[model samples]
Each structure stands twice: as structure tokens, then as C-alpha cells.
Target: MNFPIIHTNFWDAVIAIPIIMIITQLTKLIYHTPSKFVPTIALFFGLFISIFISHRHDLLAGVLMGWFYGYAAIGNYAALKTAIKSYRNANK
Candidate 1:
């Protein structure tokens, strides 16, 4: 099996963070009807972005992009859960 080499570049990290955030937010908004879909959509979008946009012909960019997206997704998910809980509590 052939393995790709990894090289880390500062600009790749800069571009990846916001892309992940945007994808995560879009997934959350569009799939509001079924909250479970948000994370799945985010994961797929994250993989897609990392594979396409962050492609540096190296694995490092891919790894970083995945890490950024994963962390951001978790944060977004937590925020959504908290908001839903608060809304439910307020209505009670």
C-alpha cells in the first residue's frame, strides 16, 4: 500500500477552520427538523472539505482539517443541545 506524506502549512489551517464552521452551521440549520442529522451531515461535509479544499498532496492538511472540523462539530452540537434545553425549560 502507498501512503501519502504529510506537510503542515499555516495557511491550510487558516482556511480549514472557517470552512468547517460554515459547513457545521449549515448542516445544523438545514437539518433542524431532525437534530440527529446535524452531526452526520457535519461529518460528511467535513470529510468532503478536507479531501477537496485542504488537499495539499499531503496527509497533514487532511488531518488538521479533520481535527478542526471534529472539534468544531462537537462545540456546535453542545451549543445546540444547550439552546434546546434552555428553550424547553423556559416553556415549562
Candidate 2:
């Protein structure tokens, strides 16, 4: 089986991941998604984007990069949450 050629680029981290993160977070807000399911939802969002939007022609690449997009969003969310928590604690 031939694996699709995949390359990581600035767009993946800078643009795609953040967009996916925002979409996932907003979705989570609307749905009241459980914390355990958050990453799973993010991954699906990434996979959807890769398949339909960004890397439609390259299935493998899309899946791989989509994984990045999902995790990246998760990480971003976690970091932001941590910072906010720390700020609140400090303020109190």
C-alpha cells in the first residue's frame, strides 16, 4: 500500500490548529461535552477538516495532520485553562 506524502507546515500550527480548536471549543460549549470526550471531538474535527477542507486528496496526510490539529487544539485549550486558573487564584 502506498502512503500518501505528508508535510507539516506553518499553516498547520498557526492557522489550521487554532481554527479547529475554536470550532471544537465552541462545539463543546454548545454540547456541554464531557472532559473525557473533548479530545475525541477535537480529533474528529481535525479529521473532518483534513478530509473535506485542507488535504482532501491525501488521505494519510490528512489523517496524520488531523491528529496534530486535534492534539494541538487540546494543548492550546489546556494551556489557556491553566493560565486562567492561575490568574484567578492569584487574584483571589
Kindly list the per-residue Cα lDDT of model 1 for residues 1-92, writing each as its tens digit.
55556554776556655566676776667756377665666666666777666663645657556656666666766887799999999999
Q: Which ranges of candidate 1 are over 4 A from the true structure?
A: 1-4, 31-33, 56-68, 76-92
| Cα error of candidate 1 at position 31, Å | 4.6
- Clashing residue pairs, candidate 2? none
- The true-structure Cα RMSD of candidate 1 reads 4.8
Count of backbone clashes for each model? 0, 0
Candidate 2 Cα misplacement greater than 4 A, ranges: 1-4
The digit string of per-residue lDDT tens for model 2 on 1-92 reads 97777766787578888888888889889999888998899889988887777788888888888887888888889999999999999999
Worst 10 residues of 1 by lDDT: 55-64
TM-score, every prediction: 0.52, 0.83
Task: For model 1, name the residue pairs that clash.
Answer: none
| lDDT, each prediction | 0.65, 0.84
Instruction: Tell me the TM-score of model 2.
Output: 0.83
